[model samples]
Target: MWAQAKSGPLPHPITAAGTAPVHDPVPGELYFWPTTDVLAVYYADLGQAVPDPGLIRLGAIDTGLDDLAHAGRRVTVRIDIEGVQ
Candidate 1:
């Protein structure tokens, strides 16, 4: 889970693939990476991008306005998704 990722710094930076409307990601759009089983969220109205190749858009987290700059800092990921099926 995300708690594990937060145990330490990430190996690489999770940058926005490109700039998308912060509004595009509400508070429940989650992206899950099956390869590593890692989860991320657009917690803020910053931007959007594929942190990795196997990244899959799963759901979202309503943590509210948290930064997504991962490297030396740990990030808490909470996600929720709806209408997938």
Candidate 2:
């Protein structure tokens, strides 16, 4: 998922620099790119390689990845933290 703002670059909440950046991302993995300020979710590998500074790993999706893969291009999504309100 490459989320881009219509007006300009998206604003990110990253205060510190990337600790562990990766060039290759796997399925169900979540990453944040500081360069574009975009959040990404990898549901499948399309043989894509991330550039330079790479991607900062946020976390992974534990379930419903199949549903995500089949959700098509544009779909409404809601994210909820397990314990945070």
Candidate 3:
């Protein structure tokens, strides 16, 4: 599914457990669950409906949170630590 989504709509591999229940998924936050291989973002404002639960946190959205509007929307990710450089 991910392979096909490389260019088109990519759907998150929802597992039985789902992502950790984020009561307040802050905008610009990204999460990935290894068990399900699902990637999600908090495109909406904080304290919105929970995306998924039981996901192994992937990372935070540094930029482009506005672009993430839907659930199955695809996105590019980049990781960097503050004060590391």
Residue pairs clashing in model 2 are: none
Clashing pairs in 1: 17-49, 28-60, 29-59, 29-60, 30-59, 30-60, 60-79, 60-80, 61-78, 61-79
Model 2's alpha-carbon lDDT is: 0.64
* Candidate 3 colliding pairs: 18-53, 18-54, 19-52, 19-53, 19-54, 19-55, 20-54, 20-55, 32-58
lDDT minimum window of 10 residues, candidate 2: 1-10
All candidates: TM-score: 0.34, 0.71, 0.41
15-67: candidate 2 lDDT, tens digit per residue = 33638778888777777776777666777777778788887776677887777
- Tens digit of per-residue lDDT, candidate 1, span 5-83: 2222334445445434232333345544444544454343344443435344444454453344343355453333455
Instruction: Please name the candidate that would achieve the greatest lDDT relative to the true structure.
Output: 2
lDDT of all predictions? 0.41, 0.64, 0.47
TM value for model 2? 0.71
Worst 10 residues of 1 by lDDT: 1-10
lDDT of 2 at 47: 73
lDDT of 2 at 36: 72
Off by over 4 Å in 1: 1-28, 44-52, 67-72, 75-85
How much lDDT does candidate 3 score? 0.47
